[model samples]
Target: MKDPVLSHVRGTPNLLLGNYDLTALGYTVDEYFVAGTAVSYRPVGELGVDGHWDVVPAERADYLTRAVTVVPADGARFNGTVVVEWLNVSGGLDAPAVWLMAHRELLRAGYAYVGVSAQRVGIEGGAALVGDLSLKTLDPQRYAPLTHPGDAFAFDLFSQLGAVVRHRGDELLGDLRPERILAVGESQSAMFLTTYLNAVAPLAEIYDGYLVHSRFGPAAPLDGRSILDPDTVASLPCPRFRDDLRTPVLAVITETDLVGGVLPGYCTAGQPDEKFLRVWEIPGAAHADNYTIQGAFLDSGRAPIEDLAQAFRPTDTLMGRRLDRFLNFAPQHHYVLHAAIARLDDWVRTGRPAPAAARIALTDDESPTIATDSHGIARDGVRTPWVDTPLAATSGLNTESDRMSKLFGSGELFDTAHLHRRYPGGRTEYLTEFTTALDRTIAAGFLTSADRQEILELTAITAEWRFDPGAFHQSGSVR
Candidate 1:
């Protein structure tokens, strides 16, 4: 399959993403590139039924129009690699998974970031349908002209975007050339990439590599729901990754995903196949975490608390979030995600395959559950100081008052009674243990030297809570 022809492209002259000013957030309207193209790619494999792909000969061509918010080269702090981050349009909003956490790292490394709006929710929807959740509703003037064909055409649209960006990058990214472009998507988009890599990728051959973060199974249908067969919907949840990925692919799943049965029984962390596949089912991490909420807004230069307030259910007001404060349970998955990006770059650039990681241990039961250590921490996944440091008993699985926060997980620091029993030597011994855990994490390649300052800063935050538990306690509580 040849790359798509850039039939037409018109930039959004005065772009406004959400409520934030472009310049204040660093990237601006002048960097915007909107394109329409003729995409011809065959769906060779019969989604759930067939293994070997054969692009359906009859329906190979589709036209798509999409947007890419470009970060100009001169203004970019690029790290030689150009990252094409797929905007996660779940809940009908443009949520950038990587840019949320890796903003600081990306800026430091000088990597040019492009946020692609390739899905319908980011394009066609208006207030009548999706309300404030719709990009068009929030800012109709800026997003009025945007449109998407449907999910069926999304893969080809994404492929075309990458193809166009690689060959015609100057028009989009300016002087910053993409040394290597890794296609990245998270959760819902990750599921799409699973299909994209298995089906479209074998044909299009566009991206250098892929980072399919926080994925389970399920490939979207090749045609829209009005045309989708019922069996296709049932079978979507159980598709496999292609063995013949011409490029390296890294998949990072959290313990929350594992225990919750996001991946089917066959898709374990260590699958017996290609050297290009690396899956890290991390312990003490959540699907949508507290850090992600705060960091995501902070990185995008939005008001963190207020934005969260508007997005969450009305019952979950800003004051409730401010009051029910406890140390977060899960470690930020983005920390490891950033490292995987670096590792994947090395693998793509020099053919140095990353070391395969040990999978998280699960319990012996029909329903999947995590195997635990004496401290009740999940075992065998990416070992972070969060699980090893021993201040709070934190797990990726959470039970909260609401479904949304419940899925994100919870953290409970050891009460003074429990702390004294666990760490009799107090803060001194705890600090020593934390230092040891930090060393172990760094040695294991889970953490890089660049992360030292951030991790140390976190330890300080924990220390404050360690001595003054009241800082995060309920007003009526007696400690």
Candidate 2:
């Protein structure tokens, strides 16, 4: 029961701190990695088949040292929540998706944050084929000592991190005394959490609540290599969850995740129960996009970086066909997630439950296509202002050939003449309706008042946005 050896890095950031600046968001950033030579874990019982109660089981295992990231909240504003993001090594680069999406809110609300480098690729370099995809390779001087035992030990490592933030293992968590330790994961990390919730939570209950965003399918591999490993097929499409749960799990899945990651029967799987679960199937959003990346730039007061997946155009070749509808998911997701984390805080503190959202209605056929209104926006689920405000009509569907579906989802804007035709009241009318909708949404508990001014300002900015004709269609046209 000895505490893991926790070390703070000072003077210079080894490969891990390579040009990744977080100061623009208002919080002073400090990076520390947790390491331990001996780690133990209780087994994550048998997998539950659909509708059958899973057999709760237990076993024991031991592993070596691993490093996890801890970012303390050191700023004027502290919201008293420590959001620990399971650092994503999916891109071979540490893609902090949820952090990027929710950082503005976390910083503004004064929440402490941490990134757990539980997987191999995060601490150890990707096995040869991926060349230098490790924090060590990125900065050997700083990251040289960092080590991760393997994927089998990741769940325990994450659990240890939760304890670190809650107990104030270091000054990185600040003096605010985090009231709730929230765990969230995006894309691949989400799947890992799904597994953790099912198998690990029963053994070690650490986090107050969980946000499984953009989770495409089932739980992570029990004893396999990390998905970021070059040889392993990391993703599995079977969407499953343990119905008999311990903590609240709020899952927000984008359109691209549905088509690409979650195949079929996820909705009807019967687990991920309503009592302990809240799943929001967003209509037109993608698995990944520039909104979060751009949000980082905006927060940092820096311009956009080189990743131009948003500007992707389909060519005659196989990679770029019928992808005209792909639009960078607007910033609505962050707002929604911000509100959700707030709800999570309330749910953990009080016994209050987070509001459940309507599931995105799927097609009758075997295929899982989202049904849409005449405006091409999703008809069901949480319809934020971006979906309600018809500047850009939406579709979550991606063509089968689109390998870039995770980074892009379907959004097609109306032509200039068509915009005027769709909204006769023009910008004035649009703003009024949007304000009304924002108010209603806030009342319904989907957004916070704190976000209104910023969203409204963004609306003003978008109103002046140069319409990209290449991605435009005539008004009343449905994709």
Candidate 3:
């Protein structure tokens, strides 16, 4: 299949052999490119001042060198421009595949998208070498240089990309100047962004904002803590090096598997004035189920695209209603998701603050009813009392409740539509304590009215003292 956009770039080869010899090993090579057009508009203050938007394709150059093209919105009008470096995080997932899924919203929002294949492991020749050598046997010292060259190459490539974008401004884009550039990454790539920002802060003034999603890193052995510790990871001090970082940053943290880790560390760290940390604890969402389960908010049909091109506007009353299903799982976090996108677009276009915190209900027992707070002190209460009781005294209650928390928290109850099912009334008294504790928290104003209403509705249909059989069946566990 021919790529419509890349077919037009002059002197660009139809097929480029990368570091690997695919035919020699009976493997097929997949060609990915950065291909998209540009959009032009006027700046807010200056009525006549024009700006351009670009959409580029992702590509692989010489060994370890991955190049992505940036097409300006008005490629014919800019003198200088900005390049967006998009990094992928999933261990072996293709970065371009992820971008293709989410790029429509980005293109309409008026920013160029540049997707890089961050992992050499998934590339043509790179994959073959790892398979031949057996990743398990390769030594870290010897393997690091060959397998993961993308890590070191990203820093230089991004810096050079900015220079190239600036140089091509007159010919490709109009009289635009390459003033601001942004690096955005998700998951494991988020960790790399931190490393890159720290490593290149001294010479490059191009980076203006960073958008990190689901950031993860090596955990400490002693306490299972993330490597977000400043002393442990030398890269954290990079944000401090910038004298005046007009560049604003937004972090969207999903509370799927990131319970007590680097996310909390990054939030608390005192840093740049333009730096803002927002945690979106999406309730009931599995680690990578964001796309499948939370697809309602995304415009999957042709409506969003039509709306962007001024062809038609969608008036589906069900659009917002469909979004409500996932909202209860993580209300605050969902708001942050939209807010981060809006803020990034605003920063690129008008240089404004991200949308103010939208009105979201805070649940009283968001973490655990018994967990510690920001002060690092454990909270004590009648529900999660601090009394010195024997393990046997609370063993039955602890065992049952802990099991229930996992069941309800996993979102299987809703998935199975077992809200109306009743469990055998074997442990009514213990269950009452759990429900009552939830009620008391609501009454104490810790939980919002909406939260109380939802809980009450859920409880009414739920079995008073037993686990839902359907949930247990789906989970393949019994207690």
Ordering by lDDT: 2, 1, 3
Cα lDDT tens digits, model 1, 1-479, are 55444333455532223344445645543434354543434454354433344564233444444455546335545555778877776545666776665655565565666777766665665212113355566667765656665666677778778876788877666676777888888866776777678777877888988887877545555554411234654555455566666899988877655654333332332354367787877777766665565544444424543333222211212224532434244444767776777778878989988657888888877766778887677888787777877676666565455434544654566678877887788877777787888878777777766776656655655565565667534222322
Error of 2 at 58 (Å): 9.2
Question: What's the lDDT for residue 266 in model 3?
Answer: 28
Q: lDDT per prediction?
A: 0.61, 0.62, 0.34
Model 3 lDDT at residue 272: 30
- TM-score (all chains, Cα) for each model: 0.82, 0.82, 0.45
Q: What local lDDT does model 1 show for residue 220?
A: 51
Q: Let me know the TM-score candidate 3 reaches against the reference structure.
A: 0.45
The segments of candidate 2 whose C-alpha lies over 4 angstroms from its true place after superposition are 11-26, 37-45, 50-76, 127-132, 171-176, 226-239, 261-273, 300-326, 400-405, 466-479
Q: Model 3, 240: alpha-carbon shift in Å?
A: 9.5
